[model samples]
Target chain A: MRRLAARVAPPTATFLAGTLLAELLIRALGVSPLLLPTPSAVARAAWSYRETLLPALASTTGAVLVGLAASVALGVLAAIALAASRWVERAFYPYAIFFQIVPIVAVAPLLVIWFGYGWRAVVAAAFIVSVFPVIANALAGLRSVDPALLDLFRLYGAGRLARLVKLELPWALPSLFTGLRVAAGLAVIGAIVGEFVGGGGLGVVVLGAMRQQRTDLVFAAILHASGLGLVLFAAVDVIGRIVLRRWHWREEIP
Target chain B: MRGSPIVGLAVLLCLVTAACSRGGPPAGRVALALNWKPEPEFGGLFEAQRTGAFRRQGLDVEITGGPGAPIVQMLAAGQMAYGIAAADEVLVARDRGADIVAVYATYQTNPQGIMVHASRGVNSLDELFAGEGGTLAVEPGLAYVKWLRKRYDLSRFQIVPYGFSIAPFLAEPRMAQQVFVTAEPIAARRQGAEPKVFLIADSGFDPYAAVVITTTQRVRERPDEVSRFVTALREGWRGYLEDPGPTNREMHARNPEMDAETFALGAVAQQPLIEDEFTRAHGLGAMSLERWRVLGEQLQELELLDQEPVAADCFAAF
Candidate 1:
């Protein structure tokens, strides 16, 4: 109970302070409600569609998880290739930069056109947004393998696969986890943006709420997205901490 | 020959109110949010504001210009006092129980027009909507997309969502021109991508671009304020039609990237539409229950009219 109270205290206190300020602002302005909505109004909007929002949350969650899983696999494979050869990263880095510069808003419509409306398009968008962080982080992790350790393993005539499993994978875990945390949030945004553009799911609800000035629903969707991002980031952090706690050598390298 | 006594009295009351003394009772400060960038399109609001006509009617007016969603959010949240939005959007919001009241019409007509790359052998509306490979630039929303999907079979065409940017149409030959008859074509000529255009409103779309809407609470609390805002807005619109003056310069100041001549041409092209008999005959901030019903019915047929209160419920006549 104390833990729960400690956890909940800050947000509750923040809300009390914020609401007091928001209400005072609204009353003082004598302005029409056509422009800036009150905090209470935003809360009400979040409440009104909590039921429908649950399903959208589920869809977003599914997209983010699937996107992260694919991103991790692709990133790990690329990191392995880059660790083996410098030429591959040099050749492919420009292509990655190209995709990075191209805004998601521009490519989303074409994805909708080619893939039609569904999770497939959402996953593609999420993947596009998520893959970069994992790749970039994993590349850094792979290259950061302690050269002295690599030399010691090479002295024992360790095979490439043995060296990777014994040394590289463990060292890369923390960086890979960091990349996962970033991917978690971005994947959610990409999925929602995909839906916002392509028209469906939680994104449509948020867009509809936005159009009609339903601050409550917008807040509700946003709250869920933020919560999901935090949860994903925390989950990755916990795993990293647990794994990193096991070895002094890995902890010392950082 | 047919003026009923009661009707005549009502007219007399209206005239008396119109001719009431110019001195204001210290009007409340009201913000007027805009639809799209400030240009010849917003001539009336600027005119009323600049001429102090709103002040005459007991209003301290602030004019803000932006797209439909943000403006509506600002208005509903009480950051703004009053605003203009698509009449259909106001109705849609009302359906969701967004307490908005449509006060008057800014454009007697909507200027949403679609254009084709003239070199693509598409010269008419029928040709533009007939087949595919040509991208149709449109506002990113359900109303227009649903209408296009329901009204016409667009299986062969690639529909590119528009962000109100002209670059897509200006650069690509295969791209169809999508613009407000008031804004985009003027932008096109400067870019040297002159395309044959089809005005949807002229063809068969009843789009009201800049509609003056107030909060329902505002209507109930200060009927007098709403009336003055409308009158002032109408007066300003009338002034804009007579002489645009530095309105283009003001618009350019808002978006320095905008070309002055292109804006002027857009105004010239738009003047014929803005000064139509609708505003001249009915009054500037007029609402057509008839047109609203038509849009509602058409939207329903398109299957895009999400369940809301009836279209008429979202609006009122002054």
Candidate 2:
């Protein structure tokens, strides 16, 4: 009951308080509605540009989903490969660092020029930007496997693959997920920044609107992008909590 | 080590295949950069390419869309043989030390204008200024905001910092805005509202917009090539005004999102703007040294820069 009150009630109170304050401020200041539009004006603007707003939301979501999926796939595969061979990890770590070191801004245009605009370029940029954290964490996790744990599995004649699936991976899940959560926030940033620079999606639209001096619609798009990032982070957090709670014996709050 | 080379090669191969698959001509490779995106304003140049005007001049043009690209750096680095820059920008750049020149005029008029609602009952500049309730939508970075303040006591008028959207203007019925007549007015008309317009030019602020630019060094080195490019570009504009059919089809092909009517309107609107004796005397794609110098002087007065940016190198007199 306390958890329910804690989780569900503050936002309602805040929203009501916020509305009262906004209306009060509007009436108090003699401020022209055009320069600093009332919340109602923003809501009306939101309704007006629903056409532009909805597509941009869809575009940004699509870019983020596609990027996250790509990151998960590549990040897992890199973990597996690195788990199998230290030589590969040693040889490629510098290059991985190199890719991370080169600012995404520097690489974004060339990605567009090379990949030819729109979702493909945006996805590539996001994937490249976000996977590093997951990879770095997963690699560290794989290396963190207890020597005695490996030997215990091997004593039963467990093969390399089975030992990896059952023993090494379970051992690595907590650290790996830490990387993924860090990557989760970064994936959203990657999509927005990539689009800001050149992706031609909602990020582009938000930026274009701002450049053209359409702050109302720009803020509306920003709200959408924020809602998207928040939603993604929440979803990932929930999944991480569930998976980690069971796998690593993490306790549930309630 | 060996596999790395192969992987690198594969990436390059993919990039080349992506860039070249929608193939056109095979002249010496050249990149023409824009001040902005694939808007209707750029249709003439694209139409020129569609009509084989650039090809006839033995040029292979790769038009890059501008999105926060540091255009002058790219030009100075020899990435693009030609770039589009406003005359005011050209002046600031020259003063700040970028070696570029203006070779062509895309829009005869800059098309930058202040728009208001007809119902505002503000008959002229004086009336607009007199009103206590009106909000003047102005962009902060644009040079003209200062010009407006210098000429008028803007402290009295409620100034709304512009963030480019028609929604703000549409949201508030009585508000005034700054926008290009070619782009925003069309968008407004589509929304079933006729907008009142006042040109900054008429208000005594002078500068050019969407003028084709190149390095002065490149012009000196490849005079004939530059001449060929300019001549073809001029022919492109003429053909755009005369027919614009093939160009429209090509522009549609490249960016199908732009509607045909709006595209045609944008093209047609830009035509009357290409007047003034400078272009009239020589041909289209003409600029006046006197005009450039005058704009430079205004920019200096406006204090856009500390000094003049480029010599009045308007026409590429090869």
Candidate 3:
């Protein structure tokens, strides 16, 4: 209980303090709700529009999960291939960086044209924005394997697959999770951008509310989007903790 | 204490810079924020700037372009002295507690419509919506979309969000997307697609488009300035209708993404919408109480507005 409280206290205190200050400042300044809604107003709007917002949340969640999964699967496979050959990395790594650097907004229209506007385009957006981090981090981890370990595996007559499964894969787990944590957040952003052009999900909700000038509802939708991101981040963190708790160097320290 | 001199110098420099940036003749130097980028949709406003109509009126107007800017909010907050918006947008803004009123209307008829492939052979909104299911690209949460849903059974159609591009519509034969009559339709034609447009106005949801709006406070405080601005705008529009060559060239330079041909097309397309029978009789940028009341009631029916806004409060017809 003490440990959990210590972990929870700071964030809770900061959030509460920030909300209180904002509420008071808005009230004191007589700020228009159109310009800025009080936190309570946003909460109220969220609750009032729960039926609509919840479904939108689920839709966005589906896109994020699918996109993240694709990113992990493809990213890991590409990283493994790159690790096997320096020529492969040299040939493909620039394109991976290109995907990362290309602005999602600029390509979103083309995504709609190619993917035909729906979950496919949205998922593609999420995947493109997110896959680079996973590849970069996983390749770094796979490459960082100690030469001594490779020699040991070779001496034991282990082949590439066996060595990767027994040695490099386990070693790269922590780095892969770091990439996942970053990708999880990016997937949400990409999904929203996709929805901006491709249609569907909370991005549509945000766009609609913005057009109508419902700032309170816009804040509510944004809060829901952030909540989705947090959930994804937390899920990744929990998975990482579970995987790494037994053998990770950090776990062995304390 | 030693750092105070530097801070003071900085503050003085900022003031000097601010004053220099506010350069113009000693008159009412005001800014007009456009809801969209420079297009012939705002030809008259551009014409006013290019032809010195605003200058002649002793009002140096700086027109800033944006992509779907929150004009009503900006005006209500006094960030800009004038803005361009649709009449329905002005009513919606007023309903949301924005104290902005439309002063002059550029497009007497709203240009927003649905673009369907000519091959579809669809004549009206009803036939299109009730036909075999296909994608209909529209901006979600628009009051007109809600009105259409209420007025027709749109269950057959898959409504996707419109991304302000005609490429999708051109690529998909079954797709019908919302368009500004002067914009996407023209682009579609240029790309070798003959699209049949069904104006939303024909469906009895018409609202004046490209209306010049300002705060109610400004109307109350500076009536002469408002009058002069409206007069200049009317003259500018008249000048544009006669020959939009200069304004189109200037606007094209400002918005290079739109090629010269596209700008010329838009200039020709918006002429009929700007100069209608009502505008002909009542002079340019004319508005009516009945139109506002009808629009407010329609919005109220659609539940887009909390209540039917008073028609009088929505605009001041000059």
Best by lDDT: 3
Alpha-carbon lDDT, every model: 0.69, 0.68, 0.85
Candidate 2 lDDT over B46-129, as tens digits, reads 866777889998888888835344455456445567888777667766654556788887766778888887778676665676
In candidate 1 chain B, what residue range of length 10 has the lowest lDDT sum? Answer: B1-10
Badly placed stretches (over 4 Å) of model 1 are: A1-132, A143-148, A157-166, A194-209, A212-254, B1-27, B300-318
Backbone clashes in model 3: 0
Docking class of 3: acceptable
Clashing pairs in 3: none
In order of the candidates, what TM-score does chain B achieve? Answer: 0.85, 0.84, 0.90
- Which candidate has the highest DockQ of all? 3
Model 2 clash pairs?
A212-B164, A213-B162, A213-B163, A213-B164, A214-B163, A214-B164, A214-B165, B95-B309
Q: How close is candidate 2 to the true structure, as a TM-score?
A: 0.53
Candidate 1 C-alpha lDDT tens digits along B69-114 = 2555445555566888887777666655567878877666777767
Q: Any idea how many clashes model 1 has?
A: 19
Supply the TM-score of chain A against the true chain A for every candidate structure: 0.87, 0.83, 0.97
- Among all windows of 10 consecutive residues in model 1 chain A, the one with the lowest summed lDDT is A29-38
Q: Cα-based RMSD of the predictions, in order? A: 10.7, 18.2, 6.2
Off by more than 4 A, model 3? A251-254, B1-27
